[model samples]
Target: MKRLHYFMIVFLITGISYAQELTITGMVTEDGTGTPLPYVNVTVKRTSNTTNTDFDGNYSIKVNLGDTLSFSYVGYESEEIKVKKNDSVINVTMSIAPGTLEEVVVTAYGARKAKKSLGYVVSAVSSESISMSRSERRKARRASKKSNKSLNKALSGKVAGLTISNGVGYTNSNSSVKIRGANSVSGAQQPLYIIDGIPVNKKDIAKIQHIDPTKISDVKVLKDKKATSLYGFRAIHGCIIITTHKGNYEIKNNESYEEIVENSFEKVRTSPLSTFSIDVDKASYSNVRRMINNGQQIPADAVKIEEMINYFEYDYKQPKGDHPFAIHTEYGKTPWNKETQLVKIGLKGKEIPQDEIPASNLVFLLDVSGSMDQANKLPLLKRAFKLLVNQLREKDKVSIVVYAGAAGMVLKPTSGINKNEINQALDNLDAGGSTAGGAGIELAYKIAQKNFIKNGNNRVILATDGDFNVGMSSDKDMKTLIEEKRKSGVFLTCLGFGMNNYKDSKLETLADKGNGNHAYIDTMQEAQRVLGKEFGGTLYTIAKDVKIQVEFNPAKVQAYRLIGYENRLLADEDFVDDTKDAGELGSGHTVTALYEVIPVGVRSEYINEIPDLKYTNSEINRNFGDELLTVKFRYKRPQESKSIEMIHILKTGENKVSKDFSFAASVAWFGMKIRKSKYINNDQIKDIVTLAEENRAADNQGYRAEFVRLMNSYQTL
Candidate 1:
C-alpha cells in the first residue's frame, strides 16, 4: 500500500519541478524590548517542517500560498501567519512569557498537544539551553585556549539530580554527560539527543561540526517516560528534543551577530560565575600522601597550568567567525511536553584555518551490513551523506564503495563538482546480508591509492557500525593491516553507522592508527555536520600525531590526576615519538584540555607528601619551570610521507584580576556536572549553572541563556 501510494505520488508529481513562485519572509523578536529576536521558532502549520531566524533577524522561506506558519521561542509569546500571497515579508515581535521554559514538543508518531494538556510529565530543553552550555565551553575549546569566560567550580548541587563527576580538569575529547547514573554500563547511557527530529547517539560528539552555538536559537527536552515511550526501547533512557533557532537572512557578519546577542537577553534568568571563587592549596587535596607514595610527580612551581587554562585566562582573542545555523520554531504546541524545558541554544565561536587545509580525494566506503535495519541507522545515513555531498567544491572528488555478503564498488571516482550524481549514488544504496567489511575496506584503499590526489587530502571514508565478523576480523591482525596501509600517502576517517553493539574499541584503533578521525553518524543532520559543514576537517588532515605531556614538580605539587580523555591518554615519551600512533586533526579545528592546581604556598594536602624514593637525578636546570607542560605535534603535509613538528610554550601565573582565568574553569564545571563522575565533591549543578549564568559571553549563542532554565526545570520532577 505504501509503495502504491509512493508510485502514484511520484507519477502525479513527475512534471512539477517548478510548481509555483511563492515567498515567505518574516522577522522574529522579543515583545518587551521590541528586539528583533533570532531563533524564534517558525513551523508549517500542518507539517513537521520548521525554520528559525538568522543572525540578521530575518527569515525567508519559500513555499506556496495558503500555508499557515507558526512562530514561537522561549520566554516569548507565539504567533502564526497565513501565507495568502506571493513575495510577502512579515515582521513580528514575540513578548516574554512567565515560566516560558515549559513548551510543547513532538514525540513518536509526530503528534501535537499542548504542554498543559499532557497526562505525563515531560521537559523541553530548547536550543537556548544548548547554546548557553556551548558558549561557556567554546572559549576553552578554541585555539590559544587563553581566556576566562565564566563558570563555578562546584556544579553538582546546582541542578536537583544532575551529578558532576570530578572537577579537576577539562578535555575536549571527553564528555562529562552521563544521565542519571550509569545505565548502560558499557553501551551509551546518555539520553538520546535528537536534533531536527533526528535521533543521534553520544558517539557523534567527535563528528560535531564546529557549529557556532550562537547560531542555535532554542531547544525542548522530552524527559517523561510516556512521552518518550513511542521510541520504544531506545527512549527508556529519556529524550532531549533540540530546537535550533535560525533566520533566513544572508548577513554573515556584524549586523546579525549583534542583534542575536542582544535578543538572547530576553530569556536570560540568572547570574553565576561572579557568585564565588575558591582558593586551593596543597592542603586542600585529600589524598596527596597516597598519590605521592604511588610515585606520581608534582610541579614545584607555584603556578598551575591546568587551573589557569581551565578558566580561559589567556590573552588570545577569538578568531574570525560566521554563524551558519538557521533556526525556526512553530507557534502551536507539539504532541509532547507535559513539563517541557523549552531551551534556545546556539554556538558563537571563532574558526581559523589551519595554515591551509589540504584538498581531498575521498572514497566513501559503506557497509550495507544487515545490522543497519533501524531508522536511526542506515536510512538516516543516506540523508546525512547527501547533505555533505551538496557542500563539496570542484577541487574535491568522491567515490562510493559498499560491502554486504560480498564486496563491490558502487560508484567510481566522481567529481565533487557534480552533486547530482553523488547524491543519486548515495540515494540508491540498500542494506542487506551479513557484513564482509574487510574486502570492502581493501577495495576502498586500492581505489584511493589509484587516484591519490598528490599533495592533497587523500583518505578513505569507511562508514559502518564497525561490525567486521567475516574476513580480517581479528582486532590485533586488523591493527597490523591498518598500520601497513597507513604508511601509504592515504589517510583514513572511520565513520560509525548505527549503534546497538557498536564496536567502538575497534573503530577507535582503526582511525587512530590510520591517522584519521572517528565519528558516529547517528542522524542525517550529523551526516551534514561530518560531511558538509566540516568537509575540510573531516576529509583533510592538517596535523597528525598530536600529543600533550605535563610533568609536575614533586616539590611544588604532591599529586594530580588527569580530568578526562582516558581514551586519548598517552605516555610522556609518546609526545615526541612520531612512529607511535596518536590523534589527527583537521583544518580550522580546536582542541582544549584543563587541570586543577594546588598552589605551593597554601597549606594543602596535595603538595604536603614527600616521595619515598629519591629521584635518580635531583639537580634540575633553570628552564624546568618554563617547561611545566609541553604540547608537541608532528605531522606531514597530507600527501607527504615524513612529518614535521610544531611547538607551543605554556607558562602559568596566579592572578585574581584576570577575566580569561575563570571562563575556562566555567567550561570544566559544566562538563563535570553533566557527567556526574566521582572526581568532584561538595559540588552542585545549581552552582555550575549559576556560574555560567553570571559569566555569559559578550556574544552568547543562546547556550548559557538556556542552561539556566534547564537547571530550574529539574526541580519539577
Candidate 2:
C-alpha cells in the first residue's frame, strides 16, 4: 500500500508536469499570399509528436520548451523552428520550391514533375497567380467579393482551350471549370480535383466558403491521351490537376475517412454467411456511363457490377402479398468461367401510378452561389423543377428555398397548381455570395415541418454541384444533420448538375442517409428521364432499410466473391439489426446483385486456401443436398420501425438462362472488361458485344442501342 501510494504520487507529479507544457496553435499559409495550406506536415523533430492542418489550414500541437519543430509541405521548402519556454503561437509561411528537373508542374495525385517529360498537352497556372502568399490571398478574396470575381472569370483565356463557364459556386471560388471539351457521354467533363494529395469532389470544395485562393498552389490541365492515361477512365474527359499548400511534417492518418475496402473471396467453411445492405442507388452506373460516353476508359474502382446490372429494369413479377417488393434468385453456370457458377438476386418494388401516389410537399433547396451561375446549373435546375412542377396536382404543395451567403425561403408553401408563382420565384434567383448548404438544409427542413403533411410525401429536392462552403461543411457534420432531418419524415432528392469539382461521393452519401435517391443531370434529357418519366419511382419510397444475406453451402461451394457494392457491404451482425440504416427502394425501382462462386471441384487462383485450423477440424455439412445457397431478405415499410423477412433457395441444375439474364451478364461482362478486372479470366470485349447484340430485346427506349454505341466507342479506344 505504501509503494502504491508512492507510485501514484509520482505519476500525479509527472502528469501535472506534462500538462503544464505549452500547446502551440497557428495557421500555416503560403509565404507571400498568406493563404492557409492544409495537410502541412508539422512535427517535433526529435519527439514523436506530429499533426497535419485541417481543411481550414489550421493546426495545433503540444510540445515542451526547447523542443525543435519541423514544418514541411510538398513543392515547398522545409522550415524548422525551436520552441521557446513562453511560446504559445507559431505561424509559418512557407516558400515555393518547384521540382528540380526541368520546369515542374503539379499533376494528378499531387505528383510534381518536369513538364518536358510529359508526352501529353499540359497547361499550368502557378502559385504566382492561382495561390500567392497569405496577404495576397486575402486581397484576392476581398477583391473577388467586391467585383463578384470567380474561378471561371480569373481563369478564362488563361489556358488555350480550357473553358470555364459561370455556374453555381461560392463567391470566393470558381464557377464550373471544364477543360477542353466534353469527351464523355455520361461522365463529368470537369477535371478531377486534388488538394494536398486528396481527391476532393466539388461538394467538398463547396463546404468551405473561405478557402484562401492562394491556398491553391497550382492548377494543371492534362489534355492529351498520354497525360491522362495514368488516371484511367476518370481522366478520359481530361484531367485538371490541383495542388494545395500543405506542411511537410510527417503526419499520420492511419484510418482515412474515405478508404475503400477491397472485397476478397470468402471460404464457405470459414464464413458461410454473406450479408450486405441492399443498394438501390444507380449513381455508379450513370457515372460510369458518363465516362464510357466520353470515350474514356472506365476506372476499375468505378465499375460497380451491381449498379450496372440494376441500372436497367428487369422483368420480374411484382409482390403478391403484404410485402412491398418481390425477391427473385437464380443460379447458373458462370459466363466468365466455366468452372465457377453465378448467383443473381433481384428485387422489384411495387409500381404506383401518379394518381395513386400521395400528394407531395416539396422544398426546392436551390444553391444560388456564384458557382451556380453557369447555364447548366441554376438555369438547368429551373428547367428541371419546371418539369417536376408540371407533374404536381392541385393537392400538392411546393416551397422555394435558395442559399448563397445565407439561407432564406423565397416562396412560401404554395399550391403546386400555382406553377407561374414558382416559376417566377425561381427566375428571380440570381447567383452570388458563398454557399451555406447547412443553413439552407435547416431552413428547408423547418419549412417542410411547419407545413407537414401527415400522410403526404414531404421531401427536399436539393439541386447543386454539391459544393457547400460555409458552416457545417464537414462530411461528418453534414451526414449527422441529414440523418437527423430524415426523422421528420421528409425525404431528400439530390440532383447534381454541372461539372468541374462535382462531388459524386458526397451527394451519394446524402441520398443514402436521407432516405432519398440521387441522380446527376448532365442534360435536359436526363432531367426529363428522372423527374418526368420516372416521377413516381424517383419520389415515392415503397420500401426502406432493405438488407440482404446469403448463406453458401460449404459442401457445394469452395469460395465466393460479390461484385461491387463495396460501400454498401455490411457485417453479418448488421443484417438483423433493425436500428441500422440501409438503402431504400422507390416505387417500381429494380435492384440486382451478382456473385461468382467457385464450385467444389474447381481450382480458382483468385481464392486463397487457408491451412487447416489448429483446434477444430470441422466437418463440412452435406445434408443441404445440392443446394447452392439460401438467400434471405429483410425490409421495412417506409415508416415502419420493424422489418419483414423473406427467403429463397438455389440448387444445382441445368442452367436456365433467359435473354434478360444474358443481358445482365453481358452488362456485367462489359463492366469487368472496362475495369480490367484480374478476376475476368478468358472474357473478351467481342464476346460481350456479341452477347449484348444477341440479347438486345424489343429496344424501345434505345438504351441498349446507346450501350452498343458506347461499347463500340470503347472498342475503338
* Best by the lDDT measure: 2
- For each of the candidates, give the backbone clash count: 126, 48
Per-candidate TM-scores read 0.55, 0.66
| lDDT value, residue 196 of candidate 1 | 52
Q: Residue 86 of model 1: what lDDT? A: 48
Model 1 residue 588 CA deviation (Å) reads 1.7
Task: List runs of model 2 lying over 4 Å from the truth.
Answer: 1-259, 296-301, 614-617
lDDT of each: 0.51, 0.76
Cα error, residue 247 of model 2, in Å, equals: 31
lDDT of 2 by residue, 1-717 (tens): 999999999999877765567799988889888866755878887454666664346788888777777897756777899888678889889988865411222332555568888777888887666544566556667775443333444456777788766545434444555676535544346666544555544444432223455555666777766654555444666766655566221122111123345567899999999888877766666666656544455556656667778778778899888888888878777778877878878888999988998888999999999778665677778878888998999999999899998999989999988989888998788876788999999999999999988878888999987778789876777899999998898899998877554566667778889988888775565677789988888888898889999999888988998877788888999999999988888899888888988988887787787898889776987788778899999998887889999998888777787677878888888887766767777667787888898988876655676576568768766
Candidate No. with top TM-score: 2
